[model samples]
Target: MSAARLASASAATAHQRQWFADLHQEVAAGGDLALVNADAPQEIFRAMGIPYVVNQWWSSIVTAKRRAQDYLGLLRERGYPDDSEQYSSIPLASAFDPDPANAPWGGLPRPTIVLAETTGDASRKIFDIWDTQPGVSFYPLESAAENDVPARWWELMPRDWERAVGSDRLDLMTGELEGLIRFLEQTTGRVFSETRFAEVMDLVNEQQEWNRRTRDLIARARPCPLPVNDSIPSVMIPQWHRGTTWARDAARAFHDEVAERVSTGAAVCSEERARLMWIGRGLWFDLDFYRRFEQSHGAVFVWSMYLAIAADGYLRYGGDPLRALAARFAAFSDQLYTPPWSAEWYVKEARHHGVDGVVHLVSEDARGSYFTTRALEAAGIPVLELHADNVDARSADGDALTRTVGDWLDRRVRAGD
Candidate 1:
């Protein structure tokens, strides 16, 4: 890796680790903790003054710590497929890890509530394990694949989402969120306040607005001021804290850092030649992969959905705050997975960032990459489809992958194929 990480990223990492420590202490003292899916309506948890762990987020930490394979073995012992959605499954398996001394974040505090949307095939089953655990309540929201795919969802999602994604879909999600609120009320003995939810929505919109500015800045900045490695945490950590004052400030701070770096002519690779876009889930276990090609090939990964999706995907501005929040999560995960939606956005982003090539990680659970790959190629961008799990390092050979990408860049991008 390059020594080019952003300050906001460093602060965010320290804050989250310490925050997790504090959260573990809270749960030990009999406080409530929820384990939620990335696409679940987190703003609701925020409004309820609850601290939660995102399943995939913690799984990344475990995978990075090199303990994922051990936990996967435990899952296999329970007859769960070792290769099945390892990213989301690792945390669940950790509950049965037997060796708590080796688990991530002191072995993810036994969640009081388990929350997830049945977006992928394995999600419901994964959360079910949490539900069956003593005292953990599981709330599974429904995710649908809408046939009516709209163009320019980034603009429509913020306000006209009901029509953009269909009113029926929004209606289902909004009702489910209402049920979630009632569940929280009954479980926590705390009144779910509309006032707090609205305020939280305001904070989220403010955060996304800052993200939009940062994305636009980087999209246009020639020499790409920061590495995608740094941008991932800079944008994503705040994303997990969407409705907080600190998250809002962090967004602004990151945007300012990117702006300052660009103004000062800073560069991740001063000899930047090829700009690339990552078109699937982040390579969490090997984020250093993004920088590996920088010195060797001058191929810099300028865009990943983490920052761009946060820029384009999270805003919703219509009626009731609760409904708007529901609208945000209703198609949240799908926007990056379903056809037309995922393909269109990737196409738009590749063009916007002036990418020379694409490394599309086609995870088994992530749908629509076939079309995504075709669309990018049709738009005259060369793409290398790397079939592997973003979370599981064992799924692909890291050294081989670097060579594959380097060869692709040299043969296709450098030769203008």
Candidate 2:
């Protein structure tokens, strides 16, 4: 069967176009804009009524529009490695592009504030490059990994986050978040409201609950009620707007749509043979490539980190919303990229989803990919390790990777079936 597409997905795309138009208009009228990293506390901006764009989201736009190669080329021309965190740094390079027609969304406006967590030495250097612009001020938060790796972090993090992640890490993150609040207040002349931020936290929790419902529904559905392609934007576009009522409503709407599809017995592939799990950032340039496997070999990709992480990663409940938000960002990178925590969660998800094979896209900048592959293989799951950059399409060979997957499915996945 042809892959089932969601109307909500197209609606999300239209909503983003309108959002960018408004953002550009705001900046043209002398409004200050912020360019933030994905792990930054976006609720602070949302509560303060400041318009911000996530760097990863903008990079996805650049990659989807097929401009990542050109942007990276400009970086390479300027003496930076084209392969180094290209997704996070693409928008920065695009700002230097003389041609607006060649840039994504007519180019990103000069940001008044650039916020990013110091995930590593490379990330700090990338944000520092942004600080070189005349008026751009950089704010870097410290990201500390947990020394004690906990099992089932998705379950522990919502309520017992303090135990799952250490207090020392939380202390540093909370301090940084306070500094960030003061910095934003000082820069924008907008007072950070405790009441408003608290309310925003409530809205975010509501949105997460809706995502949890959607994820649970999809997990129990045998053939998979929706395609991973549509679900990515459906969950993520609103995710970038996380603290608003609109984002919460969008989450609920997507959940309802998925429930309705499951009720009608909808399936992305009519003959669902092998269920595949994709573990990494999305392949933004080739989302259609996800569907190509279905027609050729009765294989359907049922899982991606977008919906799963949105479901399990963002929930934090406590009295102090700011500290709670800090806890969320503090261990966010570790839970996804670090050793035992990362490896354990993937195995749990693969088993729960009944995944037949795994496609692990290993990032060069992170650790634990080897452990993840070994653990999955030890668990009796066949693993296909693809060394490629999801954001930098030039570094990845889609045709060759697809062929590799086809061969793996035939030998390992389908052979057992």
Candidate 3:
């Protein structure tokens, strides 16, 4: 049976749509806009009153609208590799989509400044191409390697962040953030207010606190009150707007809604025989894939990295908001995609949620997927690894994937039940 959609998710979606439309109009009226990577320090933008659209967020919108293939094809025609980091490359390709009328949401407005971290060789090159466009400047932040591996990082991340993320990495990132502020101040002719930045950081921490409570509430609920599809949008839309009171309130509303559902003994699947976790980027092209197994296998995907990371990954409680923000992102990639850290957190979350099985989507661009799989299996949880691109639909075979996962549930997951 289909689960009731969360009202908070619907409201967040509607707000985002209106917000984007207004942003597009403002930019079209000659206002400057920044296009930043998902990992970039968006709080700085929020505090400075600069409008920015996250590259990955827009890429998901383009992919979900069935426009990824056309944009990806444009990349191939221009001698760029179509197979390179599709999540970042899709928006770059969309910039050249000649027909604005056919573009998703009338296409992303030409950004005045593009900001991204040099996460890898391919992603750096992708952002570099954006710089080549007229009136667009690209700023790259250095991604430092994680030297100190901490156990149970989520526990220490909120208050004891200096020890959780090594001091050396934090220092480097703090310097990078300072440089970014200087650059933005020069480009936009807008002053960077330390007071405003601190306020934004406080709001973001508050938003995540509500998310943490909601996550714990859902984990303890039987039969799962919310599906991953609903949770992803509910958490992520507000997450993109993190550092604002609106986002903070939206997060609390989501928590209250989930808490209410749990109190009422609501269930996504009436006969949920299996509680499963989805590891890796969302299946943006086919969200329906999440619900395919609900009827036959009585399995509902209750966990995804979207809400879990929002709960555990973004909190930093310290006096120095700038340094705390730096600490939050210093090894952000490592905490989610590195060996021991990624593996440990996955095992912890799997146990916390009482997950019986995991479907890990091993994307080509993401690192350390195998370690997460091994850790979950070591914890006595079965895992089904699906190798595919999260945003690119051309690489996914939906029907085949459905059959494969169905067979897996029958053989590996529900068989034990």
lDDT of 1 by residue, 186-208 (tens): 99887888889889999999999
The 10-residue segment of model 2 with minimum total lDDT is 1-10
Root-mean-square deviation per candidate: 1.6, 1.3, 1.1
lDDT of model 1, residue 32: 92
Task: State which candidate has the highest TM-score.
Answer: 3
TM-score: model 3 vs. ground truth: 0.98
lDDT of each prediction vs. the true structure? 0.87, 0.87, 0.90
Model 1 pairs in collision:
158-317
Stretches of candidate 1 exceeding 4 Å from the true structure: 1-3
Which of the predicted structures, 1 or 3, would earn the higher lDDT when compared with the native? 3
TM-score of each: 0.97, 0.97, 0.98
Clashes of each: 1, 0, 0
lDDT of 2 at 33: 92
Task: Name the TM-score of candidate 2.
Answer: 0.97
User: Cα deviation of 219 in candidate 2 (Å)?
Assistant: 0.9
